[model samples]
Target: MPDLATFQREMRKAMVAGGVPSTTLEGAVVSDTLPAERRIRVHQNNYRESLCRALMSLFPVARVFVGEQFIKGVFAKYIAREPPCEAVLSHYGAGLPDFLAEFAPVCQVPYLRDIIRLEWAIHSLQLVEEFGNALSADGTPRLSPNVRLVDSDYPILNLWMAGTGQIPPEAVSLKAGGQCALVTLSGGEVRLAALDSAQRQTALRIEAGEPVEGDSLTMLTEMGAVDFHAG
Candidate 1:
């Protein structure tokens, strides 16, 4: 008899891989109405479908761009390659951006990976709690905890906003060049704004725990990207 740990490992592999049950698992699953292999298949399908739904929800923009069947296929492979290790699905697809980067089918749409990266940033903002006051008594600048910086070699913001119908299609051009953005959550809504080179540098410096000054700070402050605190 396989130990409980060994059985769990095999069960996870069987469920995610969606292959014939290993002999050990087949022998272990005692069933009456369905054979052990058939029962395993049922569970496998359910698990795969659930994970597929999770991935779709996490990257809805990606879904709209890639189509349901194609995204599902890519997700199926991702699930097989990187099975969920935790019960919380909110953070489950963190690796998806990198996975898409190397995925051969996605090569034709090179910017797709950057789109996923932006989507993940937006998704992550949902978990950050709102902090009070961007400025403290001492006037040191403190960025909102919900703020995230995403720099892409593609016009990801234009593409994303255009694709979601938030902006006119004519407003976007693939040749319009790369973009940097500050993604933040406010009043329970996610917001994204393009940042210029100087603002991007200031944001990166803030993230790296470095001091920043000058017009960049003013720009970030006006955009509600920072608060003055005495940190």
Candidate 2:
């Protein structure tokens, strides 16, 4: 009899490589509704499709740029190359922005990479807002986990807003793509506020959990953006 590890090994092979690892599994499956290979393909498709939908949900801006058919094809290859690790589903495609940056097929669509980065930042922040408060006790200034900088050499935030219909599509000029911003959720609202160079660095440092102080932090607090003080 095959051990559990052996069975799992074969299952992985079937799901990923599309073939039986052993004759044992081949003979063991008693399917009345479909052939064994067909059944295995169904399982594989379901697993990949679930992850595909999750990726699109996380990076809707990227989805708009590539369109459904194109994005589906892109993710089919991405899923093959970067299978999810033992993490939550929301974190599965954390490396996708990096993946798309180097993906040869998407090289012409450079904006797609930056858009992926910005969308990933928003998705991550939204998840944090959904799950954690991360505010400081007392009246000390602090930022929730949802606050983070999205630095891009493209107008990725505009593209996102336009794609989501929050702004007119023509309001964002694809030819003039360059901006940076801080993404956060406030009172159940997702906001992407523009940022300057120093402000961008400050946001990055704060998100890194560094104890930030100085002009940038002072300005942010003065602007009422960094005051999480309960009082």
lDDT of 1 at 18: 86
Off by over 4 Å in 2: 19-24, 31-34, 129-144, 201-217, 222-231
lDDT of each: 0.85, 0.72
Q: Tens-digit lDDT track for model 2 on 178-228?
A: 677777666666677777768767766766666677788877654445745
**Strongest candidate by lDDT:** 1
- The TM-scores, one per candidate, come to 0.86, 0.77
lDDT of 2: 0.72
Residue pairs with colliding backbones in model 2 are none
TM-score, cand. 2 vs. native: 0.77
**Residues 1-231, model 1: lDDT tens digits:** 699999999998799778898999999988788888998898999999999999988888887777889889999999999989999999899999888877899987888888888989998888868765555556656676767778888898998997688989788888988899789787788899999989988887877767889999888877778885635
- Per-prediction count of colliding residue pairs? 6, 0
CA RMSD, predictions in order: 2.7, 4.1
Poorest stretch of ten by lDDT in candidate 1:
132-141
Model 2 residue 98 CA deviation (Å) reads: 1.7
